[model samples]
Target chain A: MNEQMTQKPYVIGLDLGGTNSVFGIVDARGDIKATTAIKTGGHTTPESYVDACMEVLLPVIEQVGGLDKIKAMGIGAPNGNYYNGTIEFAPNLPWAHDTVVPLAQMFSERLGGIPVGLTNDANAAAMGEMVYGVARGMKDFIVITLGTGVGSGIVVNGQVVYGHDGFAGELGHVTMVRGAEGRLCGCGRTGCLETYCSATGVARTARELLQNTDRPSLLRELDTESITSLDVSIAAEKGDELAKEIYDFTGKMLGEACADFAAFSSPEAFIFFGGMTKAGELIMKPIREAYEAHVMKPFRGKAQFLVSGLDGASAAVLGASAIGWELK
Target chain B: MNEQMTQKPYVIGLDLGGTNSVFGIVDARGDIKATTAIKTGGHTTPESYVDACMEVLLPVIEQVGGLDKIKAMGIGAPNGNYYNGTIEFAPNLPWAHDTVVPLAQMFSERLGGIPVGLTNDANAAAMGEMVYGVARGMKDFIVITLGTGVGSGIVVNGQVVYGHDGFAGELGHVTMVRGAEGRLCGCGRTGCLETYCSATGVARTARELLQNTDRPSLLRELDTESITSLDVSIAAEKGDELAKEIYDFTGKMLGEACADFAAFSSPEAFIFFGGMTKAGELIMKPIREAYEAHVMKPFRGKAQFLVSGLDGASAAVLGASAIGWELK
Candidate 1:
């Protein structure tokens, strides 16, 4: 793929997830085109996973409209790293922990000659926000995504906190409740913020609220197997007291978590993204109200609350493109 | 000061408060053999303040040790900056406003050989914690001093986060309560973290607790002006329910505040210092318990709760010494 490319420089973006692989062609202005998504081979075999990724990527290149414009490729994985240019053990991916260079090598060979850069999805989101999202002009802010799980990315003094070993901004895992030690989490821990604040968290909370049974609700009519965060959102929007309470509880938790973040980085704002947050004001009102009740003073009127503007499927694509624009 | 002290390589530590000015000779290991405190001369004039500082310093230098051990100096003032080596508009001091090099010039003349470095009290405390306190091994931690007011010194990635403009860590001013705008603070802001979580915050809470009825104990027994944080701590220790409740409330708020911070820098711990923290387990237990109940998950069990081992008067000296050690 690289050998046939022309003189015009172009960039590629890759999003690595548990069930699917996505790649896109982007340019300097952050526009993404020719996006392709392929089923991620279960992480059982590393080589096959690489092959599946290449399968999705090559076609995206052809869709790049004009290959002459492609210059570099940026990969956004669960645990991608910038310094080492490798991904170790990412919990979401089933493959055994290993360096990600082999896959990059494959992509480079398949796509002809081009440079590849990498970073975690959260960091990529942070870069994306700085590059083209709400935090465009601000040097400091944190982005939190509430989806299947809650993921956070921190930007301090205009730069991301990658930690010494590249595991810095793990706010979702910061414990907020007692007995959190044994709670089941994707990271093998219990009571994670993600466990309580993500879409999954909302579902868990709804189940718990339903379990108590002291409170009557229309929720009982839904089939047990299909009740979801969307149902809760809709119910709350319809003024179901139980659903409202769940969102209030969840938003309060998210707000309190953001307040804790304010004390450390003193950023100018918190930008939120993800499907759960799509509940919009349903989740945001509680977060803002709770944040006001708990945030440190300097942070009170200073940090604004923002909802991400990235389109659903397009979110990861832009984040990947932003990674390609690293240090630009 | 900079030129003459090239070879000797020593630093001085000056702590200026509304009540007094302390001068000490600090060496490479953060040791202070000579230290002395003197009146600010109500020091209506900057020259008087400087002269008084030298008089107090010179005698102490001769009495306990000598000038031979000193090299340079670090000043902990209301608004000093090590970056600009200046004190800009110290709010509490008698001087009107915008004081800087004029004060440094006087010190250089008096010390005759040492240079001066400047930073606020909180930053100094953070440095002290990093070099001489429990935070010895951690690259990231927050040192919060719960004194007359709340002040925080933030160290991230092993260094202080001096924002792009040099005024980074201001945790106390972050508002925790919305429209809790009526409480008074030194910075003139209402509902500040300092208003709720400092030594003064304790007294303030006690006052609020005492509003409905007459408490028959130590605090009410003393003249209103004389009521101290120590008195409240004693009452809480003796099982005063109001005092216990006050601490519990504050702890919960602080825990939530810390949870917000967890989202930002993701520090390893938040080390408590200052007289109010002397409440010790009473304060720490609640803080830990509430922090666990409120902080972001990944930060749970990861950031420890502890008190500073450094003492009051000695901390500034040690911190100043650390400044020199770290720099020169």
Candidate 2:
């Protein structure tokens, strides 16, 4: 293994998203030496999906000095389980929605039995942050991905908390609103943190704000139904009051949710990831303020609030590749 | 250490309560060989407090074959920090109220430098459960102590989550109610789980139930202000409608809180400890029901809810002593 580590300086990373299966050959320093992609859809089964992936992935491996130079492979995918190295019942993946797909093993078998590791994308992001991003030196932190859905990866004592089941760190589904008043969530629940703080949640908030009040703002100029979180961010940057309020509402709830989280693990920091974090201090300031205001007195001002240090476009790939380095 | 483990067959356990400091000599099987107690409050300083504790503790040490037979000492106290082995600003301890007290180090110095460890009572309870109670052999579980105040010890991946500050697992302080309608907590926060779920919280619920409605029952037979959780339990045992309702309310809230907790670490079980658990299935039923009803679909029916296995009278001492085995 020591000899292998010296000879094989690269690892393959797969960021398996709903729309695209992106493959990157990453070095130890997180540099992408070669990359390729194929559409993640149109596969009838897990075997077919892997076949299609390999067609594009093989070229990248060859470009990175062939299979002998590759040490391992890692994958970041929705519903990926660290313990099982499988993607279980993922709603979005065409081939893995109902059955457990042994993805890491399949990849390992195809890649000449080099070890492969897999975990949910959020956990991958956390590993990326711990290795090459903002959480580099911290052992106790939470990486919260505020994307299409609010996802989380929890680290404690320098390891990801996989829980009794591999499906832990579902902070996005914690009920913020307890009763009938909560917004409906895609997970068949109501009032989840995801329903109020995800990218889609932010757009919904914009829609609700536009519908509930006649407040004059730049958001009113956009088509009400199609207003995305990005539109709200652009409007807020232009000093639009209502757009700023939308961020405040989202941030405040996020902060309050974090306050509850502090009572759970008291992480060293809360590292925000994904699209919603692009709002920057617009979202961060309110989260910090609400955390201080709502958290137990002992935890006040104890946690650092920061954004992911990994560049957005390559972060998922970097996060996935980081997992390869962890393979024994 | 192996030779010491064979020669020194006992560890000293201290359960430091606000009223009494109980000391016990415990063996590997959780048996108490000797025990004694002293009033915790008469001392004016931490030094004097330790001096007084030693007076009673030395006799127990002698009864258990002297200090040479003692491997280490463990203290379970309010606001105890595992990292520094100190009791920090514990309001219940007169000497430690406003000061950081190096109680563990002091004991170690007095006992010829045998290792000493200290942690908040909740974490100690968790350790106790893992080592000797219902959580034996379980790697992931939560031990919730529902005494006068609510407390918790969260174990993940077979380790107590002390967080970055050694002050994690404050689950009792998690907010159950989000808005102004939330109850005021002793922690200077509003709507904490402790405020609504502790033993005192149950009594408070009984009081509110009697006051809010004209329901005629055995609870109204006693003065409302003086009504204790014990009184409510006694009434409920006799099938008092209002008292049963009180347990239901408390259990429901606890269950809902556990549901939220499930989203955090996804423990295999939630072990109830301390006084309120005496309500038996009355409270446990509602908690399990609420947890299943409110938890995310994937987590439903996955976790077991159980009561502490240790005898209530000696559990705290055993919990403290269990920490001794973990020291390096």
iRMSD, per candidate, in listed order: 4.6, 0.7
- CAPRI level of candidate 2: high
Any runs in candidate 2 off by more than 4 Å, and if so which?
A: A1-7, B1-7
lDDT per residue (tens digit) for residues A59-134 in model 1: 6676655455677777777767665656666655666354344555556666666666677788878877887778
True contacts kept of 2: 0.83
* TM-scores for every candidate against the unseen true structure: 0.68, 0.97
**DockQ of every candidate structure:** 0.20, 0.85
For model 1, the superposed segments whose C-alpha errors exceed 4 Å read A1-11, A55-73, A79-86, A97-117, A179-192, A210-221, A239-242, B1-12, B17-19, B24-37, B44-74, B78-119, B128-152, B162-314, B321-328
RMSD of 2: 1.8
Q: Which ten-residue region of model 1 chain A has the weakest summed lDDT?
A: A96-105
lDDT of 2 by residue, A1-328 (tens): 5755557899888999999988889998888999999898899799999999988888878887889999888899999999999999998988999999999999899989999999999999999999889998899999999999999999999999999998899999999998999999999989999999999999999999899998998988889999999999999999999999999999999999999898889999999999888899999999999999998888898999999999999999999998998888
Could you say which candidate leads in TM-score?
Answer: 2
Tell me how many residue pairs clash in candidate 2.
Answer: 0
Q: Which ten residues in a row have the lowest lDDT in candidate 2 chain A?
A: A1-10
